[model samples]
Target: MDVMEWTGQVYADTPIVSAETYVEAPPARVWELVSDIHLMPELSSELREVAWLDGLTSPGTGHRFAGRSAHDALGSWETISTIVDCEAPRRFTWAVGDPGHPSSVWSFLLQAQGEGTVLEQWAQMGPGPSGLSLAIEAMPDKEQKIVFVRLREFETGMKANLAAIKGLAERRA
Candidate 1:
């Protein structure tokens, strides 16, 4: 058997979701899209908007941003995200809520393969406070189901974002 077995299920035991897509463009082209946090609102299902914070024009390690999101289940909430990793044209990572005690950690990884770039979006849900935390507090026994559902929502959203990125990058190429 494989060392990692993913059966398309996410128990609260596994609070992560990731998706990848290939863009027939150089890493730089794809990077242009992924690193532009402001563009996320157009592609994401839950994120309503994002704006740079602390007078920063672009994200870099230690920079922060505010995001407004709305989900049918979780309703609406705003978060302050702090950039944790920034390697242009390769990777960008950030933590939501608090960098040291985040509700979630998300990353975009770009790898050059042949003439195209493989872009992967990954997210790990909290060990901190979030809507899920409230839900878990209310129904501790259904934690697994709640996490699984949220992860599935994340997977769907990431896939759509990747598709949008691919379309934009290829058209620009």
Candidate 2:
């Protein structure tokens, strides 16, 4: 697991999807586990591994990371992500390249919630290409339903990931 704060100008104007959860740990401890990009696999069962593609220092802006995630005995997806923002023990953001359906930006924010920590995750998808939009428009109602169904599926996947993180942080206390 190689994690670095992302600092770049290429994607300075991307949107983010933010979701939050409470963990039974202080902000500093939670930050240790979440900030270490390489240790993410150890923190969650769903994360198989995370690697740094570009050699860089830890938790610094503009560091690149890639990781594989699985859906407990069902399937998995591989993403090559680059850190867009890195603010220790607080917030971090990443962008996944050419994710097939839509290019996406992901972010995480951590805050102290009384004796615990509140973790928030956000994702932004789209900036779709012309051809992709055309194809989506050409699809019939049934096909359109399938598309939205898959979008929900992705959202569920994100929820599971967040749950895993929460579980890990809680157990540490």
Candidate 3:
């Protein structure tokens, strides 16, 4: 029997779901796709809306944006995220400031892979009340299940986003 010890702590405050995809585009092009955060909604179908609280410029640490995301019945919700780190054509990370949030950070890391770019999506939340706060305080177990469901949904959405970006970049190339 292969016993696996799953001692990793539960991270409710900084829960992260991550996925990666390789796109047949140069790093520079990939940067153009990600660096222009405001254009996210235009480039990716999953991003319902992205309002730059600041102008269109390469985001810096502390830069903020209000965003809404939802592709189906789940409906869209507003979130304010602050860029904690930004490194062009390589890495960008942000943290959400929504009330009763489950995750604290979301990030994108890009790298040159052969004649293409590899894009990685990562999220982090702290350990507290599952990602859901007030409404589900009465039922912790249910909230746990909901968190799992949301993570899975987010994973699927991220794949779609990457595909959309790949399509746009390839078309331009």
Most TM-score-accurate candidate: 1
TM-score of 1: 0.92
Cα lDDT of model 3 by residue, 1-173, tens digit: 11212323233434567778888998788778776777677755556787668674558777888878765544556777778778887888777774334245677889999999988876665443423554346565576665566566666667766777788777776
lDDT of each: 0.86, 0.63, 0.67
Kindly give the stretch of ten consecutive residues in candidate 3 with the minimal lDDT sum: 1-10
| Decreasing lDDT order of the candidates | 1, 3, 2
| Tens digit of per-residue lDDT, candidate 1, span 89-110 | 8999999987887889999999
Question: What would the per-residue lDDT of candidate 2 be over residues 41-99, giving only the tens digit for each residue?
Answer: 76445568888877764776667777787864237777777777788888887767653
What is residue 133's positional error in candidate 1, in angstroms? 0.8
Candidate closest to the true structure, highest lDDT = 1
In angstroms, the error of model 1 at 47 is 0.6
Q: Which residues of candidate 1, in runs, are more than 4 Å off?
A: 1-14
Clashing pairs in 3: 12-126, 12-127, 13-125, 13-126, 14-124, 14-125, 14-126, 15-125, 16-123
Q: Which sections of candidate 2 miss by over 4 Å?
A: 1-18, 39-49, 68-79, 98-102, 128-147
